[model samples]
Target: MGRNTRKRRTPLATKIVAGAAALAVGGGGLVWANFYASAHEEHGGHNRTRSAAAQVATIDCPDVGQQIRDVPDRARGEVDGELATMDSQITDAYQRLATTRRAQAGDAQFVGNSILGPLKERRKVIIDRIQLEINRAGGRADDNLDELAGCQGRPADQMQNGGGQNGDGGDQNGGDGQNGGGGQNDDGQNGGGQNQDDNGNGVAGPVADDFIDINDVQPNSRNSRNGLAANGDGGSTGTFTTECGVNENNLFNSDNLIAAPGVDNGAHHTHDYVGNQDNDAFSSDQDLAAADTSCQNQGDKSTYYWPVLRLQDGTQEFDAGDQGGGAEGNIGKILKPAQAEIKFVGSRQGDVVAMPKFLRVITGDAKSFTNGDANANSSWSCSGFEDRQVTDKYPLCPEGSQVLRTINFQSCWDGQNIDSANHRDHMAFVQEDGSCANGFQAVPQLQIRLAYDIPAPTVENGQVQNPYAVDSFPEQLHKPITDHNDFINVMDEDLMNEVVDCINRGEDCQ
Candidate 1:
């Protein structure tokens, strides 16, 4: 998912007008008149006093600052505690709403009436209580407290319009909300539905017809391929060892999973998260190292994640129904992955080494919706059976078979920068022949395989119907198979050392 480079900027005059209208509606005509006069004076190069007055009038809750100041010293702690609790509750509600929004699919009105409506009402009550307390302490409170509370009236549409209620700037439902098109990032890079070179140049690749031949992938001759080690030997051999870690059935949410460093909520879509429980856009090495872990090994604190794949049934899990007023589509409802397997595949010929901490890397392309930009590395197969592969169309799995989505990230690191401008420059995909490129260091390769228990696509009149479509991806994406993966290493030093030693010893440990 990409951030929208073009911002929807509300002009200063428009903001002023909206504020004035809100005031008038609240029977604060005198306040609006005073604000209008002060704004005009400031525009005419009036005194600083007029500018200050204009600024105060623009505050969402005009008297909040004064109310805080006027609170009696004896009750200040209690007020602070209540305010803190209110903020926490609101944060929790938003998180829950986001989860529900992604888990269930329906029209915007149904979603609003069922999920967002109750949350909004509860928030209103809290806001009213806060306002009453403020007034009781000799402070004026805004009449329209609901607006100040920022409770979303229509969350489904808003989430698709621009990355949900938090305004993370990424489209949760994928592109710009028009035919599931791509959105541009701040660097002029198109996010989702397209592929570009390292320099951001669009390069068209080979297009698959209805389906890709499973024979395209090279074959591996490894057995005992079950549980966490289902994807090849993981760079292990007679004298070299590789360690595997599995994080099973972790909760995946609709929160942003990737953004430029320091940018929070940059991913506008849903992603399954594993390892670090606190992984987010602002996550740092320190933050991740201190976070809780879902992995069996407590010392493995790295964050692993990828976009979610939904079943696309009419049930709540697959339904991105129409928003009220006729906006129809499955925008935010991305199904949680059934399971994820993580492993470190070291070079069979070299000394096993620890992966750099906080190493940021991305695999595949989230924007790869069209044939021109679809990731060559992206692969789809069937669970329990690797011989079956499908591309561009959903595979009609036999009864009892499940779908499998696998992504193998580049194992060669630049040995200097943890990340690059394009998020791919710092790492290079291992050559098809399985050799690291020049100038890149070979570290234990990180590979992720996700499984989903989804039924085969419905067919009518000899044609397959795509009910499990990715709402934010272009229709050309084909059955919503827009797959990508992200990794951030936060393993403790001792644990990394242990992993290195195990790999060097050529032991296959899980």
Candidate 2:
């Protein structure tokens, strides 16, 4: 299990079709219809009552990070720590809920009384600490934060019914419900309650309904004008492709520097990291700038990471018995991506600006399962069937077609700050008319195209044989909708300017 010695798999050639908009000049301006709006929210918020014997699928807690928008810079560290503590509290409560199924079976209110109630109490204490720290730093704290302390127990059906779903599912920081909505089975996939057992998979989620055949899916893709004109021309038409190795170095960690900086296991799930070699919760900007990179060009030392994908074939990996791994219900063997393509394109509206060094950008919501798809920007599709993209369910790729995970980062910047209080406000996606809002400048948009040579899991009889899922917070239930990616721009100044220049001039550069 040496870091660089992991077995490498060859990838088959696959066309690239990602994000809300198609790449204008880098790859051909291939149009794409997205699945952010209606596909996943079909059964969400129907308010069906669960039977008394219904099983609680997972613990549903308010996203504390989403609610706190005014944390002072001086108090961000402590508030972040408290938020990390609340996440750990939820993880602990979820573990208790998952393991004590028998006890829950006997007591009708067992989940509410033992798991959710205790979780809420702990969250209240952490919420108080967050508000206190903010106020101590001379910032006005939200007086109604106590409302976010209460947690709920969602049954499998409720989870299947995702809450507060909206069109486009691209609200980066704009969902209101504590438990937004649940997964659905609109395509005749399994939508029943959880199994009494773990269904032979050590993890708690990704039930049969979590997957659908790509061929069975209708072509719901539409051409999006991400920053491009309706004719798919004009604007910054160039692209800069960076050759970052598919994290063959086994650079993995559970800490999230952007959200829960300085906290151990902040993500509560392992992430596959490429680009920057020295990344952790405690890594400073100085540390990242001096770190070695996995990219072919030493000047482009940006950090790119995402939750590790695992195949549930009963193979125990390195973190199997550790926290953020099997202990938190993320089991199975981690799968390395067959190909990792990192490309940066310009805005279609006008010339693009260089991203400031050390700028942090996060795309897709890791908590999309409970937070709703308002901010769900990631998409899943098969190699050949690129026209069919799914936001909620994993694609059951046909034979010879690879599984692809596509993510397009927020392309518009607020111009003033490199980081925002919510880690999202500083960045925005392009509007429908392919223009950035007032005061926001268009920046080079990073798009990730990752392909995996995974064996399509056999789904039949409401059971999965070898399911593959992304690492996620335990409560997120390993749903495909919860898949997300993270990035920190550590590129040197010269290379970044070159990226901007090449993009503005409409030339493809590497």
Candidate 3:
């Protein structure tokens, strides 16, 4: 199975255009050959397993431009509701824990590590409620494509029709076995039959007989990527062999192997674009798993139960109980809207806070009172404050109406800072475009109040009096970044390649 072939076959581009079925006539076995080759060897030395998303993605298809508008069209609205619930719940839980640990502000700890226990526990209680819609959006489409793969390409179907897998016993690329006579290279794709290079690598050759049939691709790409051609029924199942092959540069490397069918699509979504860490639910990549690295008790932990949204009106949305949103529950229609983000708790110095990525938008969805202790704040009191402040000065409201705050850029961080540090105080507001809206007397503070309460983990002597870095709070943070990025490189490459393969195959993918 590891035998790398330098055999010549057909041009892939031509085969794709001709249709998935055209290649299956005698190509079904070729598909299997590939599958069999990679069954072992670290996915048999290949990288990632192609997801249905890659198989169905259409990159430069002529018809893509024609149907651009109607694209998946599934509104992200429902997902927002779900996000809001998850964001705030986690925040509140953290705050609850943060209060008890208020004593230890000097110990270093990670925001992510603190929440691991709580988040996992909460997820167990009601994962369906919080992540249902988002997960559905992310994984359901992929699942459908798998089903389609089974029915579309492979000699399995030919065998059912009384035809043997061995079309005509020939060399690995000469043809299938049986029926012998060194077949005619059918569609004239080979122009002459399977050709081999001096090094025994199949570079430019005729397309293998197997290709996804037109009927294989799901008519509704959204209904699940179930493509008939993807399924190895009578379609071609060629052998997948990875051996030395050089790129256009002509720099040959013997170990440069040929990957398995759909392998690139699965593991290399970003090979040619992205990366993965699905089990954690919060982790999409290694760097994921919302964290606050500078908090006292510097452990790699996350403490929030579930990230949720808290409205200015005191109303809140969380996911920890019965999880059943379907298409319109926690996510579908939140009778009311709540601001949201992946919440964090526990501080080192001041009261200001920062959120990961684009979370500020969720928190600023609706405005309210400043100084009212986020837990004590209500959605209603936050009413007109959608544009107000949250710190000591410069609030949008008249004097005493509420506290004014700001989100100033940090000299040490990349995103807007909201940590209870020396520079920026509390975040004033969240702008519509994912920017902090803390109107101010100075530069706009770039921090975000992304959490309600996050309890600091454990402490040695005792809880540090202040966690925020005020003159009183000292920076005790110390530890190495445990989550290394290297582990995900292969996975990332696999995901990207999957996307590219889908495009080349002319499937409707993201």
- Residues 74-104, candidate 2: write the lDDT tens digits: 9887787787887777777666655554454
The local distance difference test score of model 1 is 0.41
Query: What value does the lDDT take at residue 81 in candidate 1?
Result: 38
Model 2 misplacement above 4 A: 2-53, 160-197, 222-231
How well is each residue in 350-433 modelled by candidate 3, as lDDT tens digits?
Answer: 122223321211121011111112211111112224332222111112222322111112211224432211111322322222
Select the stronger candidate by TM-score from 2 and 3.
2
TM-score of 1: 0.51
Displacement of the residue 362 alpha carbon in candidate 2, Å: 1.0
lDDT of 2: 0.70
Best candidate, lDDT: 2
Cα displacement (Å) at residue 494, model 2: 0.5
Candidate with top TM-score is 2
RMSD of each: 20.5, 11.4, 31.8
Output the better candidate (1/2) by TM-score: 2
- How do all models score by TM-score? 0.51, 0.83, 0.16
